[model samples]
Target: MIAEVMGAICVLIGIPFFLTGTLGLLRLPDIYTRLHALTKADNVGLGFIILGLAIQSGSWLEVARLFLIWFLVLLASATSCHLIAQAAFEKNIKPWTKEE
Candidate 1:
């Protein structure tokens, strides 16, 4: 019962972050800001999705696959974000700071 409830909650939680990423990607002013939004959404979305999947799965193999997928998402997101950030830095994109 608890696992079922938690699974529902986790799945619901994942949706918002995914939506946020989509909206931010569409609405953010520039590349760097968009990237920031992307990272936040991607990480949280993946986390929640994995958590939900883990909670819902009955078999060990299924859970392990979810874990593997989570691990790959983390690895890929980190590497890709790092490269994007590096490129932004090299291009001298000014971060949206509050100093203005």
Candidate 2:
């Protein structure tokens, strides 16, 4: 019962992060900021989700698999974010800055 409650709370907590990430993706002004918001928020949200699922998992193997999937996603997102930023930089796409 406690595990279920905790898992539910964790999932609830993660939902906002996902929503905020999507909002940021759509609302942020620049590519860099959008990527930053999306990647960081989504990663944290995914972590919370994975943690909740792991907590509710019936076996260690399932928990380990969840963690492994999370790890892979982290690696992939980071790598892709970096590559995209680098490409943008190469193209002389500047980050958004406040006009003084």
Candidate 3:
């Protein structure tokens, strides 16, 4: 019972992170800021969701798979974000500023 409640709570909490991340992607200026919002928030959101699912999981294999998926996504997102930002930097893209 406790695990179920906790899992539900975690899932509920995770939803807002995804929403805010999407909002940031739409509202923020510059690629860097958008990437920050996406990577950070989505990572946390997925973490919470995975945690919830793991808690609800009945088998060790399922939990391991969930964790593996999260880890893969984390690595992929971080690498992709870095590559994109670096490319933008090489192209001499300027960050959006308040004055602009």
Candidate 4:
């Protein structure tokens, strides 16, 4: 019961952040900031969903695949985001400024 509830909770929490990441891609200014949101929150949301699914499945193969997918997501997202950020930095793109 508790596991099921936790899985459900994880799904609920993850989906919103996933959506927010997508929305943030549209809402944020600058490619670097957008990349940060797209990579970080999106990867975290994916990890959460994968973790929830693994917990619910409770099968050896399923757990293995879930972990693999999560790691792949982390690796891919991090690499891509790093590339984007580096390119932006090299191009002399400005970071966001506060209103003070």
Tens digit of lDDT per residue, candidate 2, span 6-77? 988888888899999999999999999999988999999999999998888889999999999999999999
TM-score of every candidate: 0.83, 0.97, 0.94, 0.85
lDDT of 1 by residue, 1-100 (tens): 8999999899899999989988999998777788878887978988998899799889999999998988888889878988998898999987766555
Writing each residue's lDDT as its tens digit, candidate 4 over 13-96 gives: 789889988899999987877887898788888878887887788789999988998898789888988988898889998898
Q: Model 3, 14-89: lDDT tens per residue? A: 9999998999999998899999999999999999999999998889999999999999999999999999999999
Preferred candidate (lDDT higher): 1 or 4: 1
Name the TM-score of candidate 2. Answer: 0.97
Better of 1 and 4 by TM-score: 4
Better of 2 and 4 by TM-score: 2
* Per-candidate RMSD, Å: 2.0, 0.7, 1.3, 1.8
C-alpha positional error of residue 96 in candidate 1 after TM-score superposition, expressed in Å: 4.5
Off by more than 4 A, model 1: 96-99
Model 3 gets an lDDT of 0.94
- Give the runs in model 3 whose Cα sits over 4 Å from its true position: none
